[model samples]
Target: MNHRRVGRREVLAGLAGGGVAALAGCLGVGGSDTSPLADHPVAEGLADQPTQGPAVGDATATVVAFEDPSCVRCAAFHRDTVPRLRSELVDPGTVSYVLRPYPVVFEWGEAATRALWATYERDAAAFWGLLDHYFTDQDAFSSGNVLDLTEAWLTAETSVDAAAVREAAAADGFPAPVQRNLDVGEAADVTGTPTVFLFRDGEYRTSASGSVSYEFVTSALEL
Candidate 1:
């Protein structure tokens, strides 16, 4: 993993003056590079995060969901739109889904993603369940205490070895995969959380940012 010198201000953009407004609808903007908007190869490096991979189906198409765990819009999308997408698109073999992390929202964003990565390392099957827990309990505490809360969640709610998760989180290698996702997002010109990219017929087509309706998302998939 190449350690690029990303400024703190850039990472903290979502939490600045306009805050979410800074990120809300900035679709396909230059993200350190140009967007490969046409015939682009499927990101092989982004095949899947080894921790908790995406849900695959017989579908020949794919949708990459770049989201931050502490992002409010993302939680809303998961709560309201994701289920519909699953039943209408994923289950019907219309598209496969990739859940990649883009932890650039609030201050807790990156930390929560690192914690998620660590816990996922402990038990890959608990990925979705852990997401549900975090989204449902988003307001239980602020991002500052995420590690403590995550430790408790791992100990009580899942079969993961909580101590091992803690160890992994504190280790130097914890952020490598998360950084890979960020790199992939930047390469694809993703500039915001909850950005959905549509890939079909061996081409990267359109994308949308923010919490969107299921109909809007499904229509983009051409399902």
Candidate 2:
């Protein structure tokens, strides 16, 4: 139960600029010095968050991913690398992957919330399936059509009772968690979406922002 709960202010701060991270690092908050990321809390019932808790590997290594749905880089990471990670590592239980939604911009925040609700109301498979659709069509939503595109995307995804997902998204049920995620990201000195953290053997390592290759991530894994 030693999980770090991220706050929205931190998330927005990181999205706003890199100054916050510099300050956090100077303050020793983002360093390997006793920060929550360093401690690597055990997240329970994480299925409601984004994806499930890592599949629980024997090597005691865990992957924590922070992503904003509207981020093209995040989409690229999903497309370019995550699938391989899933097949080669996550699915095989070599690593436990925990995803935290770090919704920075408003459009992405709404989508992230909808995705959370989709996972809660539908199922994990449905939620990820919808995520695949989102990444595939990341360019479809201009600022003028965020909600419209999101609604259409939800409607097209299976496993979700689209009506209910949209209802929850409109109502904004996942705001608190999303906000918390933002806060944690900022505190950890994350400058962008797709900021990843790998925890193994009581140590935490950070990844370069955006679509990092599987080789780099795997090489960092302590296993």
Candidate 3:
């Protein structure tokens, strides 16, 4: 993996190229390394967030999706590509989906933590429901309102009364699993949101970023 410094301009522009190539060349890794996905290992110590659908599968492919809730691209990917995969790939028992939170954007980390917390507190279905809420109201939770809105969403979802999330965010202690995600992303050379890794038979086969199409992911999994 390349650790070369990426320019502030490229980082700010959100260039959708840099990391591993999984599908359609859209996946973005964090660093400048050009290594293939087969050479990399999933990052270590990512927080244990509630995840859905590492569904029972015949072929048994596990995908670790690195996402930040505040990223519009992530939302778009879920809205477009994920639904297709859920129906055709995941539901049929061909894939196991593991969602890992990456806190590239500060606000996103807060949202990710709260969202995962809600999922853990509630259930997988409720997690997606709350996620849908966030996606529908993406603009409502900005940096200024990150903690407040995240807490509100969690409260509504889990009906929990604890103020720990808000307090943590205020003290910059929220996004409980941020360091783990950061470590994993750094190790995997993940640079941006929506980066995905497809592991088959315990071997890394491919990776992708951005709004990858269902057809593309389907093809990659075939390898």
Candidate 4:
């Protein structure tokens, strides 16, 4: 990876400031064949980090996305790009898609991430739905309301126990898997939401920061 390695102090400072802003140029663009992928690395040991995030497809080529639930740019990617990625890359088995919650953009992000992991533990399939829900309704959440909002959403849209999810979200500290996600992001030098890393046949290929188009991903994988 060509990413810069920062000391723990730098990482903490970055996190304290909510990291870097999303690349404005990369946001709100639909998938276009003209878009280009950046030459970035997935960082050593990042591929092996434990994650409770949901995934799809079974291809050897994988696209791992590190995102914050409350990030508007990440929401744009989820709303506009993810469906095409699923249809053309993931559903077709050309690439596996994984989402790791980084929760760096907003104060409530960690709570929302905890709720997501709770949903994943109860029903893996429901995890994706809940994630989409959070992204789709980002304006409705806050640090004070994230857990309650998640609880209500889970009750209405899934079979998982809502109270349990709320409890998990309201817990005192980070869950082990969620902490691992933070570690992975820190190790990868992730500075913004919607950072994506690509791997082909278990070998790191490239990465892109901010919203990435399906075309960019396919071009990177040489598809």
Best by lDDT: 4
Candidate 4 residue pairs in backbone clash = 1-41
Candidate 2: which stretches are off by over 4 Å?
A: 1-48, 52-59, 106-109
Error of 4 at 157 (Å): 0.9
Evaluation by TM-score, superior candidate among 2 and 4 = 4
lDDT of 1 by residue, 1-223 (tens): 4533222356465556566564553333212223342334226455556322234433556777888777777888888888887777776777777788767666566666777787666676676777777778888746557778878888888888877666655454336767777677766666667877766654565677776668766565566
| Ranking, TM-score, top scorer first | 1, 4, 2, 3
Number of the predicted model whose TM-score against the real structure is largest: 1
lDDT of 4 by residue, 105-196 (tens): 66688788888888888887788888989889999999999988888888998899999989998886666666666766776677667878
Q: Candidate 1: which stretches are off by over 4 Å?
A: 1-11, 22-42, 50-57, 171-174
lDDT of 4: 0.70
Which 10 residues in a row give candidate 1 its minimum summed lDDT? 29-38
* TM-score computed on alpha carbons, candidate 4: 0.78
Tell me the spans in candidate 3 whose CA falls farther than 4 Å from its real position: 1-10, 13-40, 43-49, 55-59, 106-115, 118-125, 174-176
- The TM-score, computed over Cα atoms with residue i paired to residue i, of candidate 3 is 0.72
**Which 10 consecutive residues of model 3 have the lowest summed lDDT?**
1-10
Error of 4 at 139 (Å): 1.1
Please give, for residues 68-154, the per-residue lDDT of candidate 3 as tens digits.
776677778888888887787677777777777665643454555554554545456656666666667877777677666767776
| TM-scores, one per candidate | 0.80, 0.72, 0.72, 0.78
What TM-score should be assigned to candidate 1? 0.80
